[model samples]
Target: MSDLAALYSEIEQKTSTFCTTYSIACAQGCGTCCEHFMPDITASEARLVGAYLLFIKKDFSLIEKVRQSIGNQEGPCPLYRFDSPFHCSVYPARPLICRLFGACAYQGKNGFAVFRRCKYNEEKTMPEHIDFHSEVPVMQDYSYLLRSLDDQEGEVGFLPEKVASMLDQLQFLAVMLDMDDTNPDDTPNPMAS
Candidate 1:
């Protein structure tokens, strides 16, 4: 398998394990975190999402929606269809950042802090809430694994964008998947990458 494919598999596996352990009810219709800015994902993530869309034969329409969703709002995500709150048009193909929510971490005094909940989650209670932050595994470790696949020389900041931009840059199917990983500058991007 390609490096991109391996990264996707690892991410999916880790995300599934984390969600299951937390009993996270992230089924269709739950657009809580989706409302926020789309997370900045690595080029490999974009490739996987694009591939999944191609696998389902929904690339065109989904990309179109992503394109339209750009610059719409910082609140409700464009991929979220308000009329039908039960499905994400690109659920399986959603970006790695989207998959990382609630299970990922933020740097802190201690190595990294697990993002245990979201605004919606704090207001709502569920049986699965078992204080996983104190014990459960996290997505950060998997992120380390992805970095191992490539040097990823420096710190890459976050930038939310329509899925179209990701797909366009991915160029996975035919365009060619190329990356510039030698640069080691840790500069923060003023806008979303």
Candidate 2:
């Protein structure tokens, strides 16, 4: 796999492990966070997600839906299909922000790390002495890692628009490759090539 893809996979695993260890989890079917908040993603993440939608899922309609939702300031994520069994259609390729949303750690004013849980997770209480900085991945640190691989400077903005922009860039790259008699689909791994 490409370095970006590998890094993304690693981040996912680390986030999952941290959440499980801290008993921080989002309630099933709870779209409150999805509806109210937009995920901040890096350009690399946007490209990966867009590639997943185009190459793996092959869901162009959903891509267009994402494009349409660019200016949508509020409501559920454009990727959230109400009728679908899964809350997030592109769950596997979801960005870091989405993966670490409910269970995250932040540095408090006193220079100590504080554990933050979803408001929906009322039943689970974090330990008083929980050390978030040591256990959980810091958002800024991960963001820097992701951005290091790409020229894109900072948070790529809201997820939908970022995905749309990445998809457009990917399509352009594909066209450029096609002109040279290279079929992007025929390759065993687009990311590796």
Scored by CA lDDT, what does every candidate get? 0.52, 0.71
Residues 1-193 of candidate 1 have per-residue lDDT tens digits of 2774666667677667766765565444566666655555565555555555544544456556666666654645555566677645566656555666665444444664445455566545433333334644455665666656643542232323524555555434232322222111333333324
Cα lDDT tens digits for candidate 2, 1-193: 2877687778778877877887766666566677676777777788888888877777768888999989766747888877855778889888777766655566677666677666655555444336644646766667677777776465567888889898888766765555322233453434445
- Name model 1 segments beyond 4 Å from true: 11-28, 59-61, 70-75, 104-108, 112-115, 126-135, 148-193
* Most TM-score-accurate candidate: 2
Question: Model 1: what TM-score?
Answer: 0.59
TM-score of every model versus the real structure: 0.59, 0.76
Identify the leading candidate in terms of lDDT: 2
In model 2, the clashing pairs are none
